[model samples]
Target: MGTLWYGGKVRTLVNEHDIQEAVFVESGIIIDVGSKELLTSKYSKVISNEVNLNGAVLYPGFVDSHLHMIGHGEKLLRLDLSDISSLVDLRETLIQHNRKLGQGEWLIGEGFNENLFNEMIPDKFFLDEILSEQPIVLTRVCRHALVTNSEGLRLAGIDESTLNPPGGVIVKEKGVPTGYLLDKAQDLVKGILPKIDRKYIKRALVTSLDDLYQHGFVGAHTEDLNYYRDPIGTLHTFYEVIDGESRKFRANLLVHHEVAEYIMQDQIEHDYVEKGSIKIFADGALGGRTALLSKPYTDAPSTNGLAIYSPEQLSQIVQKARKFNMPVAIHVIGDLALEYAIQAIEEHPVPSGKRDRLIHLQVTREDLIDRLKKLSVVLDIQPRFVASDFPWVEERLGEERLPYSFAWKRLLNAGLMCSGGSDAPIEPIDPILGIHAAVTRRKPENVGHPGYNSDEKLTLFEAIKLFTLGSAEAISNENKYGLIKAGYTADFTVLSEDLFELAPDEWLNVKVEKTVVDNTVMYERNKD
Candidate 1:
């Protein structure tokens, strides 16, 4: 006697236009979907409770194929520099945050983007004076760059003689550590403070669950559960806690690339809870200008982005992952990364195992797209990235490069399976906003400029498909969360308006009416 949901437009999304008026739910599973007269009559005896949806448009709850749970949750814990667009803005914010801190302790902050600032490069001198007497560390918006104060750099032993780590950068001016770090260089000073506590991670995990649930996400493949290599960092502790208890949400865990080889060899997959997948980064992001490229960046004519993995390293990984039944997901942001990823797949001819995926094909040439059609590849994209970078893209990558980057429409036309994701913490994990950006190819509120590769916009149906079925298919979870079919999970989202009919420009204005999971109202709008 769970519940019966009636009088709503329930779209199964298997067909392009299949919207029904009722759905039956019991034992956290969908029992039936049909007209109110049809379903109420079919499960009349089994339903002990019935709620009228009153014509709300119901869709399969979104499945974000890629997300970072612990990292996202801990965002609530740090100093927010989201508004630090200029040096003046940062100086003002940091000066204030430091005053609230205890003396001689670490004053950590995040969400600063160098590209957004007027100077484009903030040095240690700026940090030293603004918040004197405190060891300060601030991460770039991408988390790939970190700027620390003189005291902090001195504490970490980064001086004029310090050498940059492989796969990382230690920025310097005139041979002195400028207090900036890139990629692998983050390890130099992170040891100054201990990792976040286990209990805090547990709290973050539960909080992250409801946060995702409210956004119509019932499940996600957490791409890097232990990327920090600390075995803590909010991921390991939360994983242990969930293993000890029954949880409302389900998460598929992907081991870090560094640890996968050992785990695959040591009968480790069975040793951990919810471990059946893996994550790897092929290249960096366009924001960092390190994502490997076929041609040099237009802005920086001297160099193309760097590739993180060699062909041999990637091939060995391909072979290692095949021995286990787990899926593979690689982060390939630019064309060179895409090519390297494809080479691994092609050269090794990876076995047709379970859930082999190439994620974040964010920037690629037509030739690579042509080749992608040949491999066992899928798309796990951040539509909100389009929403976020609309104005900056042309300036960053140049107009000639804009057409192939974030090519949503072309991916659709190429008959590829694409799923929508927020890449939260990296982008705001707002599914409605992501969808709006996908359909409209414009920034939220259409304020700044049209999106890069605007021609790549998807139809309303296609956009929905990415968040639902396409995402489900990526992790082999489609049987449950992606469709409104009988036996699927009783998870659906209610929207204030039918999204298909809205003017493209107005899509960003769409609101969530409610989010339902396991036939229970998980989130509902407050009229006030």
Candidate 2:
């Protein structure tokens, strides 16, 4: 936990400052970020361990604003159908996965972005008949929708007469259900599945942390712990695993409003952890056409997206959280949901002293930008979506909606505090690839390699700030995390090459040379 160095071009994303040339570390914190000569003359002992980055780039390790612990672990253990296009491929992958599991055992899979599929929503009836013995639940790329084959649905007592949840819809065609569940409808069938135990969950969390480190993330906010058992216990588990091991984590955890309330009211106590913001859901995602759009879906006529909470209910929740001096972060994806969130927040009128966090601020009107600037709303966004979906965004939302979607460029110009996260399990959580997408606004996966609304792309410096400093500000940790100055945690990511000099396409292959957390090497690339 002392004396660290690398020869990379040091990037100090300091406030009101330019990038620094050199960096020095000691005692798990940045000692100095000035020229090399000054640092060398000061800390001369055991200088041989100086990492010869050889002109690579050093930047603040990613601070993923929104992430899940167990959900990401599901990616490693589940069937990864993200790249599988046709129904044939899906069946093939399932059949192959079934081979690895027992005949009657349950199989969980993740990452099937229907938007990227050629057939979009496939016939789940076929998938049900193919793997009837095992109950397989593969989530869509967007958390807003899920498809449960007939067998999985039938087991949960969902049939033709099954009514949809107030905030969700069970997509049924003819008298029978189509194995598709949108939004809260996912819980209908999911409730029937057996829960993972603490031991397995512990393993999953550890594995996910390892994956995040590989992507150059040193610390993160545990976003989905809101749904886990003893969300506080989840944080301690994460800290305990990281503490004893070489790979450590610096984390800010978001808990459900009820949980935060319990803690703040002195009803609960956990000395092992620190408090996190309150995470709440506003509406569904745009991919499933459930984003609570102001207008009806362009593709699916006659229906607007669903809202999870009415205005008054959301208002009360915000007001209550403010009384406890807790930051409340809400997820709003569609323009309508976005507007609804703003109105409720304004009506609730929390005193101006608390953090205002808006998760995924995906669809923004120009006026919303001004509102955010005035309200000081911290926007937690996903740039990978820009890279992956920009080519098809216009097709999905039409040219009109395209202008306001993923408005990173406009948000920055308006001087709104914005943070970047990959929304893993939904998007690849690689910070480098995420940065590339943020800058280029192009997804190589798409056929056209189109830059969707190119003017919305952010500059290199600005984008890096989102994954680092901007994220820190969201949780009110900017003074300690976002800077490389003395007393800041010596958390940094070293890439194989200088990112500023690389072509956009080269991002896909760029490897993590090292990831340091708490002034120690957490992840070092294999030297094969």
Candidate 3:
């Protein structure tokens, strides 16, 4: 017997058609979709269950194309400093959190951004005053940088004698280490932190998945390779959940470039898992002024930015990924980094059908967008970044580069498949917020700017496709996911209000009333 679901406007997202009637599901698959009258005439007798959508709007289940699942889960367990705006509050929060820690345990926290702080850049002085007994490490909101106290530096063996690594920096003052680590340099201190138990990891993953489900996400294309102490163990935990308890949740994992070789050698394979999309950091982030740029930063002219890998090195890495039948999702925020990535990908072409991805694309020129289109690469973009990094971005790139930055519509017009994501933990995981940002190109708060790039704003339909079809293409799951039609997986995101009735400004107000995955009600608001 199958399940008969009705009572909503079901947007199929295929050919822009919608069904006002019913959808029949059986064995985790959408068997049919039509009107209530016809579905009742056909499947009423055989249906075993029914769902009342309560006149809500139904959309194809949303897919977050880029996120760090384990990292988000870990953040849930750590001290969140995202809202800390002053030194006093930061100090108090850390002191309070420190008091709860067991003796000798390292105090770790993330999501502290100096941009939001009253004082621009932070030093370890204040942290040292509050957290002297136990080592404390606080990662900046960007995740590319971190600040540590004296004890953390001592435990990590970092001192004035410690030289900066090739692609990272150990910020120092007056020839002495300031306990701030940037990019790869963070590994030095993080290496000394105790590993999380495997059981806790499983719990974190579950908690994270449940949170995502509540946000209307059916699945996510996440990179969890280095987010945990045991990357393989984390992967195994994901498989255990998928194969055992949480079969409704779908996750497409990307192997970190550092571990692609090991995965390829081990020949690890699972029904829910696909192999060989290595994540490479071509450059750092724009907030830190470390995203490689074609020209020097307008605000900071001392350096263009940091390039994690040379063009040749990137080409060689792509070649290795090609050998392993893996695609590369290179993080390229600045124009220079994008150019290097494009050149490397061009030099070492993957097989004809394989799709490599360019993550971020925070800063780009018309030429780079054209080149990316020609190369058939996927654009994995975070729409929320436009709303979050505006006005501030103007300072980073100046008026000269502003026109070409965050040009999602231009990429779409140029025939590029752009997958949407929240970059969660960095931003909120809500898809409505992401959709709102993409459609309005404005901040949800409606405070600073009306629109960052009014011309680049996507239509509501187009933006939804980015989270659905575009995300499906990013994970190479086009055939199975991204639509709510017959012969498709029975996954849907039910909204509390009709999205079509709402204006662009009201998109953020729409809530996920219910989320169904694989014909099962994974999450339903107000239902236990």
Candidate 4:
């Protein structure tokens, strides 16, 4: 039987003030939407069920344009270090976590940001002083680098004699390995570590789905290929997530070029999964100084970051994806990396309809906005990054690059499509946090610090659309989801309060009252 939902404020978000009070759903599709009296009088006979919203505010479910689902899932079960502000805090946390680990078991932790620490970077020796008996690997918040203890390095066979791998760096000091591996070099230790089981990978995927649902996410464009080295194993984990009975969300899997080939050859498909999307790494992250930049980092003048792949190499990958009518999403953080990505796309043109993406345009030239508009490349941005990186970003990029970095509003004004994401596990998976960051362009609690660029702030409606319509466009599903119009999918996020009515700071405190997909309530705040 079809359902009729009414009795609350419904915002289609086509404009700042487009509101309705009722929506009719049949076969999991919105067939009509309007005022309660209008819809009820129009389709009274067809409706068999009803949901009273009780004054809640309804919006289209959020779509996270870029994130690593498997990693986000796995991190949920790992030692969390995302909030440590000092070395003493880190040491104490690790010492306590180590006590729980069995003898000889590796103690792996993630989400550490060295920028927040009194000491910029923690070396291998720092970890060795606390948990030296067993192996230890602490990943930076960026996930582009990691610091390991001597025992962990020994297990990976890294030493003074080991040369850095292509596209990766082994930070060394006085001809000795410093226990920090950047970018590709992370494989040195990751390859040797005991692999996670397929069962756990599946469990992690399920856990991430539940968590995202609580945050009002119904769909996401996620990359999980690197989580498991075995391509088949990674695919199996994804299949389990989508095909399992508990599955309630949709995911567009952005496969690495390596895994994309396998899936293409095998023709893998699922009801809740969309394939033919390829993911590429143009460079590393800015915080790690691995994101390729045109000029050297102001703080470190000796090196100008690293380019993971040559322009020619990226072009070749793009060409391959084009053959399959797939979209290619490149991770570009610096101007240099963005330039290389543009060059590759130019040399190897994709089909006219496919929308390739430029992820993390944190530092880019304003002049390139026109080129991006012409190429029809969507900008997949993380709004939370502005809140997390500001003030600190000044130290890394300096004043010269400030105008062009995180220029989301500029790009949008220039007629380029920009979608929003959390880059979850890197930031938080909460869509409200992303929205607050986008609208306020400042930290929630810090009112004194000037925004990185206040002029780049988006309006509340503009920010919400980035997670709805803009994200749907990025995934090539704009007409199917992202709106409350008739014929759109019946997926909605019901909030405790009207977002537009709240103060800027109050948006951060907003909670999800319910999450509905296909006219079924997937998450209820009270039950959770």
Candidate 5:
């Protein structure tokens, strides 16, 4: 028996203007797509169910090419400081939240951007005044830096005497620890946080997936093995959530390099979950001034940036992954980091069918783009970054580098494939918001403002392709997923309005009507 879906505008994505009236799905695979009359007549005998879209618009299911699944769930569970605009507000919020915590529990908060604060940076003195007796750790929005109280420093055995780890920093003033940790130094305190059990891991994965379904995401290529610190149990938890429970969501897991060998030894591909690539971090983030760059930051000239791995070290890691027939997905935010990543890939190339991914090519040059075009690689970009980091980012890179910073359209025009992501928990997880950022290239609030580098804006159709076809291609699943035509997986996202007709701003108000995966309705808007 098959399900027939009709009375909707279906964007096949085969071309810009290919719209079909109906689609038929059987056994979780699309069987046919054509005019309503033709599909209804052809599958009439075997049709067991019929779905009436009622003037909605349907497109290929959305997929996020990069995100931390468990981190998203943790953000939901922990105290969120993303909205605290000032230090006074943060102190008050933490004071209120501290009252609800159990004895000896660390007061953990995430997503604080000092850029919005009148007090340019956070210090331990302010936290000590609020709750000097207890330990607290507040992570920056970028997740590359954090500020903790004196108690937290004591618990982690970090002080002025402690030397900074390789590729990490402990911010200090006058030989005194200021409770700020950058890059890998964040692990010092995070490693000692109360260990989470399998129960917590399962809960986080389930919570994140449910949230994704509601947001119209059919699947995500996520990285989470490093956070949970239990490779086998975490992998099993993913299996239990997606396959055992029949959640009907697809997941392409990218195992971190630290745990790659363990995962590769026992990797199994199921209907809903599959291991994809080896995840590596070549450098830190721009916000933390840790992203390796060819030139010293224009704003801060003390140093260039932090490189997580040297050129030789990065090459060795890529070669190790290649030995197992696995592709490498390295995070590279600065041009220097991108150069290291490109050199490593050129030194140890993956198989022909597989593709290495360079995540967050935020700062790039024309020469690097030319070099990238010659390789078999995918650029996993977070479009929403433009909305969050704009005019302020200009100050960091200076005027000369503005042309290549966050150049999404330029990369596509250069004939390089780019997959879109929100980098959720850092940015919002909504795919519509991501598409809007790509199309408008500005924050929603800045209505009349001609976006920062308006020339880099993507067309509406091209932005949508980043979440659909481009994401599927990143995981090498384009053949069976990310399309509305026959022989594709029966995954669809139904929206209340036709995005093509509405402007990018209107997309923010559009509702997700239905999210279907494997011919099963996973989420539906409540009419009531």
Candidate 6:
């Protein structure tokens, strides 16, 4: 039996004017798309159900090109310090959260940006004042850096004598440990923390997927192997949760390079879960002044940034992933890191039918773009960073670097394959917000302010394509997804209003009406 969906503007996204009135789907595939009267008459005999769009608009289902599924779920569970603008509120929130925790439980919080804090750069002394007895760990929004109390440092056995690990740093002041861990150094404290149970892992995955569905995301390319510390178990849990029956969601799993070998050996495959690229971190993040840059930061002139892997080491890692017949998705935030990534990828090409990905090209140069256009790689961009990082980020990069930093339009114009994502848990997971940021190129709250680089703003259609066609292409699923044509998957994101008709500033008010995946209505907005 087939289902007929009609009465709304069906944007196929093949072209600007390719809107249709109806779509007939059967067995999770679109059987036909045309005028409502034509589709209804053609599928009248086989049609078992009909969905009325009620004047809402429909577009190809949105897929987040990059995100951490489990981390997003954990963010929902943990103390979210994203909104803490002052050290006083942070201390109070931690105190209140600590009071609710059972005795001896490790107090963990994520999404604290010192840039938002009035005091700036929190150290061990600030956290120790909250609780000297209980171990506390507060991760920066970038997840590349974290701050802990004295107890956490004691538990992790990190002191003034502790040497920084390879590709990591233990921030210190006046020969004393500051309890701030960057990059690989974060593993020290995390290693000692209690192992997460499989049940919690499953819960987090399920919760995150459901939340994504509610936000109109049909699927996401998520990296979570590092979170659970068990690649095989985590992969299995993903299959168990995203099963086509109970939970109808698509997932492209990016295995962390640290556990890529194990996952490649297991060879577990599923219809709904796809084993995608091997994720590697080339450098740290910009917020912590850790994103590796060719030159020193404008504000922090003492150092350039943190590079997680040298050129040779990065090349070796890429070669290793290639040996496993997998593509490498390297995280590169700074221009220097991008150079290293480019070198690594150039040295070891991805396997046939696979595409290497460079996530977060926050900083770049014209020469880098020219080189990138020649490579078989996709740019996984988080447009929302403009809304969040800008104005403050200007201070880090200075006016000279502004032209090349976060230049999505330039990258696209250069004919580079670019996709969109929220980098959720770091930014909000809403594609609408991402689209808004891409189109407006300004903070949603302060729309009147001219965008940091007003010339780089993308059109509404281009922004929408980033989440649809661009994302599908990132996972090599462009043929089966990202369209409303016959034989394509019957996945769609229904919205309360037509985005093209709405002003860019009003996009924040737009609501997701329904999220359909594989012919199933996974989420529907509550009428109440």
Off by over 4 Å in 3: 15-19, 244-246, 266-269, 447-449
> Per-residue alpha-carbon lDDT of model 2 for 56-86, expressed as tens digits?
7777877888777567877776677778777
Error of 5 at 372 (Å): 0.7
Model 5 over residues 1-528: C-alpha lDDT tens digits?
999999889988988899999999999899999998998888889999999999998899999999988889888878988878898899899989999999878899999998777476777888889888789999999999999999999999999899999879999999899999999999999998889999988888788888898899999999988787789889888888887345888888998998988888874768888898999999988888898889999999887889999999999999999888899999999999999999999999878898889999999999899989988899999999999888788878898888999999999999999999989899989999999999999999899989888999999989999999999889777898888999999999999888988888889999999999998888899741
lDDT of each: 0.73, 0.75, 0.84, 0.87, 0.90, 0.91
Q: RMSD of model 2, in Å?
A: 2.9
Show pairs that collide, candidate 6. Answer: none
Model 1 lDDT tens row, 133-237: 668898777766788889888888998888877667788888888888876777788766556566766776667776776666666667544544445343456
Taking all chains together, each candidate's TM-score versus the true structure is 0.91, 0.92, 0.96, 0.98, 0.98, 0.98
Candidate 6, lDDT over the whole model: 0.91
Itemize residue pairs with steric clashes in candidate 2: none
Model 6 lDDT per residue over 165-193, tens place: 99999998887899999999999999988
Clashing pairs in 1: 409-456
Query: Between candidates 4 and 6, which one is better according to lDDT?
Result: 6
Evaluate model 1: give its TM-score: 0.91
- What is the Cα-based lDDT of residue 206 in candidate 1? 69
Tens digit per residue, CA lDDT, model 3, 407-439: 999888888889999898888888888998998
Report residue 36 deviation for candidate 4 (angstroms).
Answer: 0.6
lDDT of 2 at 270: 34
Q: What lDDT would candidate 5 get against the real structure?
A: 0.90
Distance from true location, Cα of 518 in model 1, Å: 3.2
